[model samples]
Target: MNIGGRALLNGIMFQSENYTVKARYDKEGNIFITEEQTPTILDNKFVSFMSSLPFLRGIVALFRILWSVRKIFIISFILVIPFTLLLQNYKVINDSNINELTIGVQYLYIVLIIIIFWGINRKYGKFHGAEHKVINTFKRYGKVELASAIKTTRISSRCGTNLVFIVVVLKLISLISGVNSPLVNLSIWLVAYEIFELQETKLAFLSKPFITIGEFLQKLLTTSEPTVYELKPAVEGINHLIKLERTNN
Candidate 1:
């Protein structure tokens, strides 16, 4: 899977890809995405409940996206900082205590495991090279593309770096809280951040241009063609182009 970095950093766009999903663009500047999967949390019941009251659900979703940045101190405080503080108050050691591996073999094994996991994630996960290529492609277009703007893109300007910063802050909060269990504090933050992740994805899709284009094109094609007998000459030209497209195909 590829996730966009540019959207997170510059607030220009958000891009992502999954092997199970696909996106494509058609003529007339439309983009289409396949394998869309909406989480159950965003079901009709939740949306309807929120819609029953004005601004409540909208406000909640908006705040969730902001919290994903992890830089929003208020969100961090509500979700993460308190746990960190609790850890600090309990004298939790956030740093790994396994540094005392006097055996060179044991230390080497730990290092190897870290390297292996890093390699695996880099090769297959959201931070892979494919995402970078997609982001670069999107940047090249002025929010437009010829073939399919929905090229698999995983580049994210916001999620990774901001999430790391959030984790670091949470760790510090745990230290400040005097919590003896840094791992526990980290776990709490991770769970809270997962909620933020889902919300961010929804917002990203809504703001995505390629997706918008695809949807618009789908609607356009589905609608009936208006009578154009008066413009037969233009129609002939369009037919020629369409024939060319078919021939090329």
Candidate 2:
């Protein structure tokens, strides 16, 4: 799924639960590709399993990020009290009151989670940025170039950060009816998938907030500027994928 692994460095391996591959360049101009299968979601909590493995770095562990665990929990920290408060505040959902204490807890939780995510970014952000550029370039032209990739934005409509932002928005809507539940989060993802998959169509304007949040997170937490060498691998890797896909078809 990480087509951008083409831009990554040689030592790192890209692995998500679905598929894993390592792309490397040799002195003879050959592209050597290696792959592995990750464990099932049933094996462990998705994010915990992803984070538990020291073998994965960069975008490989992206989907398994702390914010990407179980659906709505992506903003689990920020909405912890908010969720409970939202459900408890209304008569139908429950019988309780929303107070200043709940609001304060939400802000405190936000700061705490931001610190955690920012710390993770400090380690793998360069590759994260490279991944985004390669993905954008490949999506736009069906190929990737180091130069064009370097000029591309680190933000993408398909970014996990954007998905998280959208989830937060949807969760807010659920508060009106006091349906604070994970099942709502699951349904949100189904709709979100269409939004992301069809983002270039009318979904583009509808998904603007996701793109905006993605850009902000790219700047603040998920990505760092990439170097020429980093960009080179991505270009090569993506070109390899293009060639391989052509051959397979």
Which candidate has the top score in lDDT?
2
TM-score of 1: 0.30
lDDT of 1 by residue, 1-249 (tens): 223322111012232221112332335434333333234444347555763443354444444455445476766568766775776577563455322322333336445644654554433332222333344444555232322223433333333433433444445554446553545654645543443354347666433443344334222221112122211212222223233334443
In model 2, where do residues sit more than 4 Å from their true spots? 1-20, 24-33, 36-113, 172-177
lDDT per prediction? 0.37, 0.58
lDDT of 2 at 191: 58
TM-score for each of the candidates: 0.30, 0.57
Prediction 2 global C-alpha lDDT: 0.58
Q: Which candidate tops TM-score?
A: 2
Name model 1 segments beyond 4 Å from true: 1-34, 43-117, 125-127, 135-155, 180-249
- TM-score of candidate 2 against the unseen true structure: 0.57
